[model samples]
Target chain A: MPVQDYIRDRFFPHIWCPGCGHGIVLNGMLKAIEELGLSKNEIVMVSGIGCSSRISGYVDFHTLHTIHGRALAFASGVKMSRPELNLIIPMGDGDALAIGGNHFIHAARRNIDLTAIIMNNRIYGMTGGQFSPLSGHGIKASTAPYSTIDHDFDIMELAKSAGATFAARTTTFHIKEITSIIKKAILHEGFSVVEIMSQCPTYFGKQNKLGNSFEMMELFKKNTRKIGSNKKLENKNLIERGIFIQKELPEYTNEYSKMVKIAMGKKNER
Target chain B: MKKNISFIQGNEACVQGALYAGLDLFAGYPITPSTEITELLSIRLPQKGGYFMQMEDEIASMCAIIGASLTGCKVMTATSGPGFSLMQEALGYAVMTEIPCVIVNIQRGGPSTGNPTHVSQGDVNQARWGIHGDHSIITMTASNHQDVFSVTVDAFNLAETYRTPVILLFDEVIGHMREKLIIPEKDDIELIQRLKTTVSEGVDFRPYLPRDDGRIPMADFGGTHRHNVTGLFHDMWGFPSNNPKIVDGLIHHLVDKINNNINIIAKVKEFHIDDARTILISYGASARTARHVVENRRSRGERIGLLELITLWPFPSHIIREKCRNARFIIVVEMNFGQILKEVKTCIDKPEKVFLANRVDGVLITVQDIRTILRIVQ
Candidate 1:
């Protein structure tokens, strides 16, 4: 399907600033949806407040633009209510791993059959350049005027630890890789996390003097390595980018399906 | 012949009622009075092919019910004082999003953790406005085990009909007290499945719109009509918008949806009002005592009557005001420090003659206690 046909064209002239990586991530999602042959009615898109959250309005699907950081909790209810439905949650860095961090872990731990797409732009872009949980150490934000002291959370690692069945990471610069990973994440049977390392040309890019959207996209491209590219870029090296991680844990759907069968068996016996 | 079943507790009846309602999910954490509702369901739900989960806490339990309800399942959660406080936010979300579910709060005493195992009707105000913001509700209060069974089943029907959360506000005394409940077979009782909306092929499916009859049909989340769900004030399409007219229209629709159906929501029972000099207004367990108190006075050739409020919210103001209009006195009896009494005062044109007989020591009010108040007021 044409991107224009899939998106609500009236809400478009997309909200992201020129060259913002969120646009790329969203495109990857549209492509994934098309490739899977998923009907729009089969997908419920939930989002929290932020630039990334705006994706709900743009997409031609059932959507809930929910409260800050509670998108996962609401999605949990939606998924639990209709286990047969495919639920996708798109949130900014602050929404996924900061204010909503608790729900993220618990949902993953339960292995609720859902997909969470975290757009990690490394800074709080919407409310001006403030320090987000994903911001690098020594980086300055509106709140962190001086060199930042807090260590950033590795969201992919956190997802793996929290019992995510599928975990992967990619930057917006690697469109094909991010799209491919999203396809894999959607197909995963349990809680899947695709942490798209996107770029914020407006606030984050300007603060770091990264020129504009093109420069930020260039940065994403420079940093990422392709999945199975075997190009080991050191973490310390700023230009290093690649599919830094990939793994499969016990998917929650299988476990829950077992629970349903057991519960049903008892019902039949009685 | 009607089955004159032996006495059973109100909480136990609520459990039986849940089964009769074809409840598919029971998620709750144990709290006094209300705990038996969960205990019974934990055992019985699995037998019926339903799901039961004892969540980490009340918050998770609340979320679980919301989750299950979304799956096109009838769900219920029971809690008391502190647990009810924890559930307010989720409850608010349910109200806003128009999710169908049931919540049972067997109230205990407190602004905090007051009386865990004791009866108190202190949650009346909390039930009405527990969550922040303006919203209308479908609520029922059961004064005895029979009402518990009937009202609980009714609660399920109301939830499905209105597509909103319905609170079954029972108190600790009634929750724990054993009384006879003639359990009805599943087939004899009517059960309501939530109204499902049709996604018109061309027109956008607006989940929040009030039907011509002022009710919204809830969509099975995954079945079809993947709608934009939000806490923000949105148009019928469920997209978040801050437009002034949209917000006004949405709030008005939510409130009017219930208000328009007020006649169906208000339920009360009247007793011995003809030529009575005094009227005793009460609900929940206290209503049982007031019944006996009025009976004793009637046996002595004294003129007295009782008004039992089965539905607490929307306050039954017209019935109350009319009932108390000609009475010499109106006595409000409860097991707490005067919550519903204030509501009575608002309903009555004559407030000075209104007497409050309240007890907060976590004990069930006796007929003698109400009799003593009747004497003092007389």
Candidate 2:
């Protein structure tokens, strides 16, 4: 399928920075959706406030660009009512973890069949360079100007433990891997989470003394190891990328429907 | 399909109203004074092939209903004071984005959980201006169980017609009390479905374009149009824009849509106001006491009247100005400490003419309060 087929023609040029990884990830997302053969009317792209959440605007599907940290809540409503509609949520680290942390875990725990794609750029890119809960320890940020001390959350572990049926990780640098993993997440029957380690050249790059946009992306390729690769990890601190959790559980809305059916049938019998 | 007159609580009547009005989804959180709404809907909606869900919190509940509404479902959620407070942000989102949904706020005593089981009309002002930003809202108050059913049905229709959020403000006394109500059957009841259109997938469909009457036709999301929706100041195509003219036009449309058609939005019930010296103003449960006062005064040969407001927002200032013309005194009665009185005080140039008979001591305002106010004013 042509890449332009998935893009909303009138929405360009997108509002990201010159070297931002969002556009690449967005391209991968579109390719995944296109290759999967989902029609525009059957899909709904939901997003919350952030630089990353703006992807919904540039997409041609039925899009909902909602308030900050509330995309999952709104998408749950859409999915619950029209369970046949395919729902996808694109969230930023701050949108997924900080303000939206409670909703993130709850949506995972409910195992509602919606695909959540978290764009982890370390710093709050939209609101300047404030540090997020996903900014690694000792990372310099505008809010943490003095080479500050703050621990970051492991995205896969969080999603896996919170009952996600499919939790996977890939970087924007790995375009083919990201698209393939997103496709798999979309096909999963329960809540699926995809955490893409996107580079923020304008914020995290300049703050952490990473050489430039090219170097930052290269860092992703250099410092990550796939789960099934035959190479031993010499560096213990390197990020591990793969499908961390793939277990089928009764999806929330389906279970709710069955419960309702039984209850209604019993009431009718009584 | 004759009227089924049965003894039921006001909350139950509201549920009946929702069903008769073609409600497809109910999303709400259980709160004191309004828990019965959630309890009944959780069982009733699924049985009727509609969707009912008790969300994690009031914010999610508000968002959920708005989401369901976008899919062309008539959605509703009910909550009391504290829960209503949590819903203010999502309510603003609904207003800004032009989502149609009904919200029932059963009044309870509170700055913050002051008294959960008790009744107070303290959130009347909050209902009008609770959500931040400049926007027009429609709110209706019900004084009894039967009115709760009728007003709730009307609220759904108003929301559907205007493409805006409608608030049904019911006090705790009215919400909890059991009264004999004549619930109209689904066929007999008036129902308004959202506007529908069939445009091809790639056709140019502007979702926010208003008709000559200023009502924008709404479509379900999965429909052929598949338009983009956002909460920001947006163009007719539902995409964000920062052009001065575009934002200004969009902002004006939000208020102008309802303001231009106040004749249809404002509803009131007037009694003996054509020839009277003292006028009484009230709504919700407090209007019941105002009625008793008006009746006693009329029997004693005093030409006192009552203007009971059924529709409270895009407020009925026209009715107030007309009724208060011959009335030398305009008194507002409520269970709360002067919420509706503020509207009455500002509705006319005669602010001094507006008197408030208020009680927030967790007790129902009796007819004696109105009589006491009349004696003191005289």
Candidate 3:
């Protein structure tokens, strides 16, 4: 199927700024869904409040544009109640780490069948560039006028530590990799975390002298290396981009079904 | 027919009522007075193939149920004062998005965790106006376990009928106190199932478009009719709209749906209200004491009566006005410092004739306490 088949063409042009990396993430997500041959009716795309969350509006799937930081909590319920539906939750940096941090970790810990895409722009673009938990130290934002003293969290590390069965990282610069990783994450059958290092050229890019969208894309290409590449030995500071963890685990919804069966059996015995 | 009876707490009765109402999913966080609803559902729901989720916090519990409701499930969550406060934002979301779910806030002493184990009716106003915006909500309360079960079932029915969230506001006294509840048979009570659209696949399905009866039939999240659901002021297609006309229409729709049906939504139990000179008004656990006072006083030929309010929101002003039209004085009995009293005053023609008999402290108001006020008013 054509990629446009998965998009709500009437809602476009989207609300994202020019050269925003969120569009690329959306494109890659649609490509992954198309490649997987998933039906729009079978997919539920839940998003939190942010520029990245606008992607839910552009998708033709069963979309839920929820409050900030509660997308995963909402998605968990949808997945648990209707295990047949595929839940794909997309969130912004602050939406995922700051206000919604507890839900993100707990959703991972439960190993529920959800595909969480953290659109890491390192800034709160919807509210006009406030520093986020993904904004590393010395970063400038509308909130952090003099640059931030707070260090950023590693999204992949957090997901892994929180017991996500599948964790991966990719950037918009690596568009093909984003699609590939998302496809794998969706098919993983457990809680999956895929952090897409999307760009906010209007906010994060201009605030820090990152030149322009092109320069930022170049920076993503220059700063990241594939996981386990020999270049990582040469530059320890270079961010690794690739699937870091993939394993079989007891998914929450599947385990719940088994539990229900046992409970019914016990009730019948009485 | 053998009677299916069980002596249980009010919280357990709520669970039974929800299950009987075709509850498919329940998500809750443990809080005082309301925790038993969560505990019992965790055990009972699975036995019936229903899902029970103990979410991380109150906010998540509320959000989760909203999500489950979108997937065509009869969902619910229980909490207390603090948890209900945490759930206000999500509750507003559910209202704006028109998700059918039930939230039970077992009232406790509040402002800020004043008394977790004791009863208070302070959340009356909060339940009415807790969420910021112009909207209407359905809130119900009961004085006893049997009433709790029936009111809970009514809550789900109302939620489905209107595609809105319903609040079951029972105080801590009713929540924890054990009483007899006869679980009704499946066919005994009428249950309102979710109304789904008849629009077939390949056709445009406007999820927010109301039918002639003012109800917007739902299409499950995973169904053929895929659409958007947002908390923002949206169009019939459920897409966000900033047009002033659209916003105005939506606000009116949200508020008018429940407010316009005030007479139909309001539920009250009137005892000796027809010819009583003095009418005592109360709800939740406080109504029990008020009823005792009315019954005891009436035996001696005292012209007193009690109006136990089952539906609290939409205020039931018309009913209150009609019931107290001939009364010499109206005494509003509750455990809060004039929460419902203020509402009663606004609804009645003679505000001065309406007096408040309340107890703000943690202790439950006794029949004697209301009697003292009755003596003063008489």
- Scored against the true structure, residue A180 in model 2 reaches a CA lDDT of 96
Off by over 4 Å in 1: A14-19, A123-130, A136-139, A144-150, A205-211, A221-253, A264-270, B1-9, B29-33, B53-57, B187-189, B198-204, B224-226, B367-372
lDDT by residue (B1-378, candidate 2, tens digit) is: 566788988999999888888889998988989999899888888887788887778888998888888888899999999999999998999999989899999999988988999989888889999988899999998898888998899999989888899999998999999999987755776678887655555678899888876768877878778788898999999999999999999989899888878998898998888998998999888889899889887999999999999988888888788779777888899887787788888777789888988888989898887888988886
Instruction: Residues A82-138, candidate 1: write the lDDT tens digits.
Output: 667788999999988887787789888888878899999888888888989899798
Model 2, TM vs. native: 0.97
Rank candidates, TM-score, best first: 3, 2, 1
Highest lDDT scorer: 3
Docking level for model 3: high
Give model 2's docking category: medium
Q: What is the C-alpha lDDT profile of model 3 across B187-249, one tens digit per residue?
A: 888999999999999999999999998998999989899999999999999999999999999
Tens-place lDDT per residue, model 1, B1-378, is: 676375778888888888889888887888876888888787677666567776657876886687667768998999998999988888887888888899999999887988788888888889999999999887789788888999999999988888889999999888888878888755676888778777665656777777787778777666556566677788787767899999898788778778777777888898898677899989998998899999888999988999999888867887788777889999998887788899899878879999998788888899778878877989
User: Alpha-carbon error at A171 in model 3, in Å?
Assistant: 0.6
Name the top TM-score candidate.
3
| Chain A TM-score for predicted structure 1 | 0.90
- Return whichever of 2 and 3 wins on lDDT: 3
Give the residue spans of candidate 2 off by over 4 A: A228-233, A266-270, B1-3, B198-201
The number of clashing residue pairs in each candidate reads 21, 0, 0
lDDT of 3 by residue, A34-102 (tens): 999998889999999999899999989999999989999999989988999999999998998899999
